[model samples]
Target: MIVSITGATGFIGRRLVQKLAEGDHEVRVLTRSKENAKLLFPVEKFPKITIAGEFEWKDCIQGSTAVVNLAGMPISTRWSSEVKKEIKDSRTRVTSKVVDLINGTSYDTRPSVLISATAIGYYGTSETKVFDERSPSGNDYLSEVCRVWEAKALGVDKDVRLALIRIGVVLGKEGGALAKMIPFFMMFAGGPLGSGNQWFSWIHLDDLVNLILEALKNPSYKGVINGTAPNPVKLTEMCEKLGEVTGRPSWLPVPDFALKAMLGEGATIVLDGQKVLPLKAQELGFSFKYPYVRDALKAIISL
Candidate 1:
């Protein structure tokens, strides 16, 4: 199968591309820098893969069996009005472009599956609620971003299988939120952010990549699916587990006020969270390698 992927250089996208290549599938990565993509995924190793710039999306997506749309700006920053517009435009505009391309293509020529990325932020921050794919969407800033992003992807023709993978806080050693937090924990300054009571719905990077693979192969696995582990942990418990995994102290906590001052509205990403479960993924027989926070933390921190 030939797979066309946007945001192919992102943290999750990189691993996903490698996995597809390892499975002996042809990959066309839609990137702004073909040179950089080649450096990361060498031609000798990933000979089946090719990298092309955004202007070449038509060529990159042509004859593809699957199109994984992961293009979007990183949301972890001070949310100035300008940054907010960038965030919204980054997701909505790219998705609209892909949907238009897919819609314009002939039914037989178009990709069969469109596996797009969304997030648990669609559910909003709620300590008491356990959200599944069927849960109603929240009206927060992140939620609005996810809502519009998924909306555009869903606009693809009915002939295509659309898998909206609502990702959670991905735990891995290489990149993502864990990479940013591990350094502080290793230095013994790590602790819970904000009140530490917020529920954290997270998944191991390995599990997430596997879930994507499953979506690609399963025709019936369409619609929304949470890319989270079965178990959700409180922020405080997560910090404690990370501390244990690294053999460091989890005593020093960052106050909510301090985080708000530093990150502005972006602090909500760390200070607030949701209790999300991969109900649909599990129902579709997708098992997670790391379902618990302790085991996930140990695996990531050990690396």
Candidate 2:
């Protein structure tokens, strides 16, 4: 199978590309810089590198069995009005381009599946709610972005199967929310972001990539699937687990106002969270390698 990926240099996307390449699939990546692409997967290690520019999807997507769209602006920083526009455009615009390419391609040559990225933030910052793929979207900055992003993916022609992975916080050794918090934990300054009650739905990086591969290979894996662990843990529990794994203290606290002041509206990315569960994936016979927070943290920290 030929797999074409956007945002191929990103944390998860690059790893997905490497995995697909190792699976003996033809992997093509859409990147802005050939130099950066080489840096991501050295030519010596990954001998076959098919590089395409941001607008060159039409050229690169030919003969692809799947096209995975993971391009977007990071929502981890302060969200000024300008930055918000960038956050919205970075997702919607790129998705629009991908849709256009799929629509324009000839029937026999177009990719069969579109596995686009969404976030668990679609459920919003609900401390009390248990969200699944069937839940209605929440009214928040990130939720709105996710709604539009999924809508664009759904607009594709009926011939293409669309799988919108509503992703949660991914726990991994390389990079992600865990990478940002590891230093603080190592220094014994790590704790829950705000009120420790809020739920932190997360998935192991390997599980997330495997979910995408499942969507790519299985025709029945269509529509929205929550990309989160089955057992969601409270923020405090997550912190405590991290501390246990690293032999550090998880007693410190970060005030909500301080996070708000530092990150503006973007603070909600950490300050608030959703209790998301992967019901669809489970019903479709998917199993997670790290279903518990303690096990997930231990694996990541040891790496």
Candidate 3:
């Protein structure tokens, strides 16, 4: 099978690309920087990987089994007017181009499916609400971004199956929420980010990749699927688990005001969170290797 991926240099995209290469499928990494993609996936190790730039992106997607769209600006920093515009445009604009490419393809050359990335932030942050794929989109900046992002993906041809993965916080060894939090724990200054009561809906990176693979292969994997572990936990609980695994104390607490001051509006991502669950994945008979927060933490720390 041929798979074309955008955002191939990102945290999730890099792992997804590696997994696809391991499966021995032809992988085309569509990036603005073919040079960077080549750096990440050298011919020496990833012999089956092809690097594609904007000029070749259309050709790479033609007749491809799947086009996995994961490109976007990272939402893990402070927000200014310019930065907010960047975050929104980075997703919606890219998605528009992908849709145009897919829709413009000849009937026989169109991709079979389009697996696009969204975020659990679509549900917005609420200390009390538990979100599933069926929930309505929230009325925040991130939620609006997600809504527009998915709408753009929905423009794909009627024959092409579309799976919008509304991802949660991904826990991994190299980079992600875990990477940011681990250092604090190692220094015995780690604890919950804000109130310690916000939900930390998360998935192990491997589980997330597996879910994407399932979506790629299974016809049943259409529409919105929450890419989160079955079990969600409060930030405080997640901190406790991290403390246990790393043999560090969960004592220091980051004040909510501090997070807000630092991240500006972006602080809502961590200071307030939604309890998102992978209900669609469950209905589709998907299983997670690390369902619990502690187990997920153990697996990550062991790595």
Candidate 4:
């Protein structure tokens, strides 16, 4: 199937595009920087990739079978007022635009499916509570942002099979949480972040990309699906597994207060988290390549 993706230059987007192209699917990258997208998916390397300019989003969507929305600002930063605005706007605004482009297309021409990325932040930080796709959304700042982000996506016509993936902490090499933690572990100074009791609901990058692919191709994948592994470990346990995989000791700990001081409101992402499970995905018979934290850590860190 032909797929049009927004934020095609992002971490998940990049991997998803490559996997889709490898499966002989035509991919249209609706991006702000055609040159950058070109560099990332060069014609010599990816002949099926079409780097659509900023103005060609509608044209691209009309010709595609599905559209994946992964565009968003990095939230792992100091949450100043301006940064917060950027974080919210980047997801909600871009998603609104994508929906509008899809809505404007004729029924026969518009994409049949829309797979959008929301985060587990939608459920807020809850160490005690377990969350599934059916759970109610939280009332935190990030929750509001995700709520608005998904609301914008809901603007798509009912004919579109909308799949909103509430992604958890992504574990992978080169990027995601591991890149920041692995260096400290390699130097033998790594430990759990914050209070260490927070739930660390995570998914292997490969599994996440596969989930998106499944959502894109399977009509049964409509509605909310938690993009997380079945096993949800606490931050302390996750750190222990990381330490084991990296051949280091989980001794030192980053205090919650210290992290709060450094990242401000952004600290909630690491200091507190919800235990999200892939209930919907499992119901649909989706398989996770790396379900356990220890094994997931080994797959990434060992590489």
lDDT of all predictions: 0.89, 0.89, 0.92, 0.91
lDDT string, candidate 3, 107-145, tens digits: 888899999999998998898988898899899989899
Please say which candidate is ahead in TM-score: 2 or 4: 4
Question: What global local distance difference test value does model 4 have?
Answer: 0.91
Worst 10 residues of 2 by lDDT: 48-57
The number of clashing residue pairs in each candidate reads 0, 0, 0, 0
- The residue-by-residue lDDT of candidate 4 on 1-303, one tens digit each, is 999998889888889998998899999999998989999998999999889987888889997899999999989888999999999999988999999999999988989999999999999878789899989989999999999999999999999999999999998896777788898898898899977899999999999999999888788999999999999999999999999988899989978887889899888889888899999999999999998999989988768
- Residue range 195-240, candidate 1, lDDT tens digits: 8999988899999999999899999789999999999999999999
TM-score per candidate: 0.97, 0.97, 0.98, 0.98
Clashing pairs for predicted structure model 2, backbone only? none
TM-score of 3: 0.98
Clashing pairs in 3: none
Cα RMSDs of all predictions?
1.1, 1.1, 0.9, 1.0
